[model samples]
Target: MDNNRLATKPHYQILDGLRGVAAIIVVFFHLAEPLASNHLDNIVNHGYLAVDFFFLLSGYVIGYAYDDRWHTFTVAGFLRRRFERLQPLVVLGMTLGAIGFYFTDSTIWPLIHTVPLWKLLVVLLIGYTVLPVPLSMDIRGWQEMHPLNSVAWSLFFEYIANILYAIGIRKLSTKALACFVVLAAAVLLHFAVTNANGDVTGGWTLNFEHMRVGITRTIFPFFAGLLLCRVTKPVYIKHAFLWCSLLVAVVLFMPRIGGATHLWANGLYESFCIIIVFPLIVYIGAGGVVHSKTESKICTFFGKLSYPLYITHYVLVYFYVAWISNHNGITLKQAWPYALLTLAGTIVLAYASLKLFDEPVRAWLRKKLK
Candidate 1:
């Protein structure tokens, strides 16, 4: 949910920068993923929680930007603005996935070769809409709606939240909104505590459980974020940006608690982090200010890069994961060069796409569609 809220209102620059920090850590999390056998041992263990933070951020920003504008913000207008802001990078992510798909062929995904060219194109076309496809259409073994760009699943849920907001949630009284949030939280708690994995992960696949995971992940934090925006009384905090950024990093990097025997331990931890800690971070970020010229530039640069980096970088990750699979037993030390290359390549590609494709296309869409 690296959305275009800045277009509607003055951004909390610190929040923008903190988002970029989380996105970068997600890259590191994905990098470390290929090295781990399971979630517990993974370095950057809680990085998946970043998606929850993102949903919260999106809700808060959307509420801040649009809550008062309901008098003027039609459903069609809201959807159009959201589609323009989010869909371009989605299409680009899918395109990169397709472009890199063949190069990623390996024992881990040998079916990549068997997939008919027509089916690949078909999946790519479906992916452009950012809608979930059934397992029958899954060309890759992963059964993702956008198999080319697996991350598009979250964007799919993001659209759902937006649609709900535009149609109904925006009109609800604060008390009613609180009730809705409570219901969503119950669902989230049930999902987290009962989940077999001992954590709030697995929302990427095209299955019932995964769909539930996606929805559970989306609704609570999003509504909570909206609630926070509605009820929060601002208080200034010194060094808020740095403090919030460190909090995010620490939460993301913390080692997985509880062994297999105590799965609920980790589940409770994940739920508590999402339900409580992320909101505090967002509150702190929203009340923060740039303290100097250097800090201003830093926030501006990261704010610009956050969305592009999140959307584009995973394509390179697919390549890296494939390479690792093909070279069995390749240690991080042995693969450091390729890992560094993946990181640098994602950053470079993201900057280029922002300048060349995203900004131009958005400008054109705003001219014609808006």
Candidate 2:
């Protein structure tokens, strides 16, 4: 057994830079959609697919970090680490949002009448691991929700992957095959059911149709990362060819292959994207492509602060929108300034928070836990 292979530290900085890029793309996607209507030309709106990138990255990093420890990893230790990594900022964000809601004229009435205290507590208890529906009907009123608990949908799957890993589920090759088969079958079943119901148009549903669909959609991508982690390849020739093939697969699927005939096609395409992209990133990181002194400093700083950036960027976006909306209506042409300002502000705030809040608290908790 190669102890060094098992003892790999996992590249942090490059992955963090990639994560920053993904977050920025998602924010751009959201901002672009509203601004698109103002533009006379059609534009590509695949920014939401950045979420898939994040999922792929999560799978790779989690597998790299925890796979070696799976046999002896305790649930308590695993959860404690997860909580230490995630909870502090989440609690802070939710509390700040609540306070902002309370102070702003945005109606404590809505928070009282629409958002039930019990439900909010349930959401917080879930530890931002579940994606709440964007809208829900309650007895008090019709509630429009934006997942104050956002960034969690992917975390839900991360937990799923972690649990599976802990149970040694990935150790059984046959079982892994069966699991993939089942996931594929479930995805096909969903598409068939939805097509039959003629619910092709995207909309909200009581059973959380979209979320269920999303889970199936992402399974293959997640597994692709897992498979990459467990396998080793010749970096020079074979790996490059494999990466190229996966990239080609993504390109083929980029065009919307219309109708029920292409239902599973989209998932397959996304899987290919993950298959190629994740390894390419890993290879680049491992091969010292990004380990230059200058690159290392930049990547390490951004990566260390990436999580805070993800959590706080939305607040920056909200203020950006407010500023743009107030100072003459924002047009597509006007989006560049707002986007740049918001991006810069997000980076600055994220860096400051990581330094002043996250790092110090994390250091203290590490000492206590030790």
Candidate 3:
């Protein structure tokens, strides 16, 4: 019966492949630290935009997977599924980070206290919804803003979006129109806040401290994704111009828009993401770019492991670099080897988590809950 049920379900391999792509981009973006020094920061800095891609993708996938079930959106079921999907790997990552911190020097005990037993207890019990502080002490140093459980920050909004969906907010209209309105409001709010703040200096105020602000900015993009699920037009005709126009806008306007520009930039950027970038992703998925029998095997493997890869890669990168710096004279020029090492280690760890942790727990949850 379970096998039959699984067979009947829609399998969006393209979305899985997209997850693989997003995870890889994030890893490479961090890799830039070891590879590019001040000379190439601008070129590589843009890779952070991959997070936006993940956000957009999440919006689409959630909508695609659950739109028909909008009437069934229930708080208990929503939280249960979300908690099952997200918590295993998150807890694993946090636990690993806490253990790593505990084993470090005693002089750093106060900092370790930041992620101490009590905090771990809180995270395990309450699911770590509180804001995370930066992980490293040296604010001016290379990994200044690093946090132990940094990647989980985005999951906060992901969960919020899910909660909103589950609570029957999505049944107000056709999913597409609902998404359009929400996205529009987010963009407008972002612009209003930015202008009111007198055109601030950094990228959109989209980091951890301003999480609520970030969630507001992203809601529209996510809903835009939901709309994509209902899109039936041919991708080439539907999205090509959108992509071209947005690409042109980003290239032409991003530089001139100037410092602390996440507000204006995110609004335009998300528009492009929704109208242009996301469609391209869907096109790639629909095109069977990774759907050959051999490719399917590879994609399935990576797809299954992608979540852990996304969560753990950054933590590994930070710790690997820290350990390396403590032992030897490593420089940015020597980043390739370290990057490769980090990738290899992360992949191994991710695979282990998938097999030993994620899959088992997920199966257990399904059986016990269902």
Candidate 4:
């Protein structure tokens, strides 16, 4: 085998930057989440949409990275790559949550200290696999798949997408994939337009409804991204990163539409963005090249920072939210300083996690497994 062909390829640098940008927005979303009186009013209201954005990016990048390598690859090997890439951070995020759990005791989760250590450890270890724990494992009272780290729900869906791609979906003809993507898109539109909330802002809690939301949110972008990679050639779009970043920010940061009365308004808006807008952004991002050294460095840094930030940032938010609940009626003005600290802390922790933990561990795994 030609070793170079089997080796990993260079990333689409701009997409990496886009991923980082979306990840950062997700953090802001979570921080703002506790502040929202309800899901409708959260200033970073559409921040949850970034998860779907991440799926699009993942689909594009995975298609770019692996579609042509199957001759030399196996399903097991592909899964190994994904596990090494994702699971380490899963463990770290869970650990951080466990470490901070008791200390964050407040009205938000007043029973935090009451949970037995054994149950917490059980959830933590199961979380290492990124599997969704059942309601019986609801140590934190939120009933999330991984209460220690709620974001793992997305990662669980991410693994499903990857497995689907590896086992069968990636084998389909381009025409077939397109048909698949269209069906998936219909699922997404139906859910987004008519769901009870009028927005596609959930999937964290494991339930039939959330599962439908989760599966719908995941498949369309991912398969559409794969189809995009297969059918289109990336074209040069000047200022691609800037344009894409702005589009993402505007979409995610916009206020909920039609208020409580016009849920379909918000639903249709979100559907339009995810179905049409996000894929367009990815296509543009993939096409653009970095022209300046400074911009190149910025993209590289954000690319490295994105996953770790997304995976681990919520550990601190658990406490931030608890602090808010403890202090009744805390406004953003009063909480801004602490919120800044939470943001800064997550950034620092993500950097540390990337360099100090994730990279080294993945390197060692590759060496051993290979």
Q: Using TM-score as the measure, which candidate wins?
A: 4
Cα lDDT tens digits for candidate 2, 107-212: 2234444566677565444434333443442211223222442444455555555555555555658457457745754563455344532222222122466555
Ranking by TM-score: 4, 1, 3, 2
Model 1 global lDDT (CA atoms, 0 to 1): 0.88
Error of 2 at 293 (Å): 0.5
Estimate every model's Cα lDDT from 0 to 1.
0.88, 0.52, 0.56, 0.90
Which model is ahead, 1 or 4, in terms of TM-score?
4
Tell me how far candidate 4 lies from the true structure as C-alpha RMSD in angstroms.
Answer: 1.3
- CA deviation > 4 Å runs, candidate 3: 1-8, 34-43, 70-73, 103-110, 113-147, 175-179, 182-209, 233-271, 287-291, 323-330
Please write out the lDDT profile of model 3 over residues 76-134, one tens digit for every residue. Answer: 76577668788778778766755565444333224544544665555434434423433
Residue-by-residue lDDT tens digits, candidate 1, 15-83: 889889988888898888898877788878999899999999999998888888766647888898888
Worst 10 residues of 2 by lDDT: 197-206
The residue ranges of model 2 lying beyond 4 angstroms of the native Cα positions read 1-12, 38-44, 102-146, 174-206, 234-272, 275-288, 322-329
**C-alpha RMSD values across all candidates:** 2.6, 6.4, 6.2, 1.3
lDDT of 3 at 86: 86
Q: Candidate 4, 59: how far from true, in Å?
A: 0.6
lDDT of 4 by residue, 1-370 (tens): 4322386788899999999999999999999989889988898999999999999889989999989988887898889889889988998999998898878878767568789999899988999888889888888888788999889899999999999999999999999999999989988888888888898877887788888888989999998899999999999999888898899999999988899998999999999999999999998999999989998998999999999999999999988998899888889899899999999999999999999999999888778777
